[model samples]
Target: MDGRHSRISVLMFPWLAHGHISPFLELAKKLTKRNFHIYFCSTPVNLRPIKEKLPEKYSLSIQLVELHLPSLPELPPHYHTTNGLPPHLMPTLKKAFDMASPNFSTIVKNLRPDLLIYDFLQQWAPSIALSRNIPAVEFLPTNAAMTSFVIHLTKNPGVEFPFPEIYLRDNYAISKFQNVLESSANGIKDTERAVECCEQSSEIVLIKTFREIEAKYLDYLSELTGKKIVPVGPLVQDPVHEYDEKPGIMEWLNNKERSSTVFVSFGSEYFLSKEEMEEIAYGLEQSMVPFIWVVRFPGGAKVSLEMALPKGFLDRVGDGGMVVEGWAPQTKILEHSSIGGFSSHCGWSSVLESMKLGVPIIAMPMHLDQPINARLVEEVGMGLEVERDMNGKLKREEVAKVIREVVVEKAGESVRQKAKELKEKLISKGEEEIDEVVQEVVQLCRKKNRH
Candidate 1:
């Protein structure tokens, strides 16, 4: 066996969202190859889907631990994740999760892991690790550019409103910016939590980005956080075979022409509002491009998608569209020869996934880090965000226009070309980021052991 990673045991605890959990799981798989023992911890329901992905071979090296979510009046034990929970009740889940610290602390003391890699939700994790003399790493699984932007904002609170010159220069205006930024004190806590975790941690800020794409941002993040920042490459997954639900998604794509269809999804955590969903439906219907759209609902939502969408929208877009309810094999769909563009929510993973497949993005960013992700996509020339009105709502015509521009029209040639070039660059770099991180981690582990 290679004496590379030196049998370091790491406890990985990501935020409750599937977006957060998936990347940790992917990292766990990669680290196990480096012979790092991983104790992958998450709530039971969140870990349920990924249980089988770990083969019989790595069972001993990569172990799954259930950290149950405490029951609250707003979020019960049955409600395991933010995936299906409504927007209003999210704070309840966070509250319950925060309350679980004693239990997590108990597990940490008992296990005495070598390192703790955690996500943004838990501000308390870094302290727990330090209290036990275990090194802690804060993991940022999104684009480095966005994280850098967040850090820049956190460090410079005096800059004040109107969203820097970059966002202001374009047709994208101030009112069209993030609601949390304009209206309330919301989202500040998460930003503070991330900075706190970074400041408290002993190791580098581990991000899911490559140097070539976001090197400047990486340096800036390091400077801002007062910690070394290590990029873990893009960490993009391809054609995930874990779930075998419907061959129909592939079948429909097979029938479409090459580079002619748009794949649409908003990741698992976000469920669009009725008006927003209807507008998107109208937009997709009007796009006139062949499309596969994945739609999700809040777990307790009583309405079916049929009743929610615009009346006659399905009948109008028939033959040219395949509207899917619930989960879709997104990677497989993106990998299809006919899949040309992605109408995405600008979730960092989805953006990277589309770019990884050389599929240009029709960026429709929703809340949180998405707006920043959208801006970065625009900056990089791989995608275009749909323009919104003064009231910050999308129009069907604009939606169709952006999709056509990204996919079929001559206007999007640069985006298409850039996407292909980016895919080549990101994919070819492969595990260079991983190799570097492994060396640093191994060194950190060995040094700690010597001490």
Candidate 2:
């Protein structure tokens, strides 16, 4: 308390997924601006890319710390991260993570930071922090609507979600979500882990959302959790320095008309099945809209793009499409003048990015909170969800119809206008939310010192 102007130190621990680590890094960058020193912790495999992405200026304020997970038989050092991990090894990865609790405790003891900001899962993190008298808070990168929806189900079982607009009406989605909630790693269910993490937070829970889009959901979540829900303002990545990664795509986009092209990507972790990819390709071809579609395969997957896609699809679409494999500059592309709509898997981070960049979404929610997110997208009037058939299969015609309606049709004007309005609203708000966040965090640190 003596050095009042001294910078506060925080250690950020997100889950192994790229989606989780990304927002945490964005939040760390924001905190560094307000006189906060961040210790970004993760596995070595995950840290490598982060190190490359970090600019030279942040070398002092932001330091990377590696937490080594014990290598099991099938889980090697490289497999410690979930970026390109095989689906079946998920449980093993979680087991390895849990086993690393002792190593984390060692790091915590050595660093001895004022506060710990951890992601969902790993309730053990806060327990260790508490033992050492360090205040710990949970930072969920997921949106408020989905977070509230899951917590509601966990706390009040057998009750219907109050908001009818957001639901898993698709039986396939419902079954998958149930599996996710009931699924266990190291003898703890996922939902139970989430609930416990929220309960263990010192007083406040930080979420990656803004009040303009989810005021009611945030309020409802606060009521449900009995803790203040702090919206951290979307936490979208800054695209200023990411332009050099894919110049050809940017050059192609420059030639397109304003608000005429769609950018398609699922996410880093989830690889689309062959059938799913084929359907989307046909749909895109039918729509006649210029698009830049990014395709990804799992680690050790040798399937070529030619094999995965329909025959002659590449030559047929020729100049109208750009089929990029591996990765693209998502934020950079979304912010471009040519990208009007996004054909996305509706992952929470992607959803926030689209809204922040003022690009309307052609939501094709695949699984696990995506359907609910898609529903919220339509509810807020910022996007339209593509309709699927009875068995929850994506139809080519419906996909084409929604793509046309969202991007190139007269009916989509309202959606496009709404996207721009939301973007302006977010821009005007600027750093107001982060200012409030700083106050709340400082108060927590002070209270701990007083105790």
lDDT of each: 0.80, 0.91
Candidate 2 is scored at a TM of 0.97
The best candidate by TM-score is 2
Tell me the TM-score of each prediction against the true structure.
0.92, 0.97
Give the per-residue lDDT digits (tens) of candidate 1, residues 159-272.
752334234323343433443343222243666676787788676778887777677777877777788899887676646684458878787888999999999998887788
- What would the per-residue lDDT of candidate 2 be over residues 1-451, giving only the tens digit for each residue? 1224468999999999898999999999999988899999999999999999799899999999999999799999999988778778888999999999999999999999999999888999999998999999999998888999999998899999898888886776787688777878998888999999999999999999999889999999999999999988988888766656677998999999999999999987788888889889999999999999999998788899999999999999999999999989899899999998999989999998998899999999887778888988999898998887888788889889999999999999999999999999988998777777788899999999999
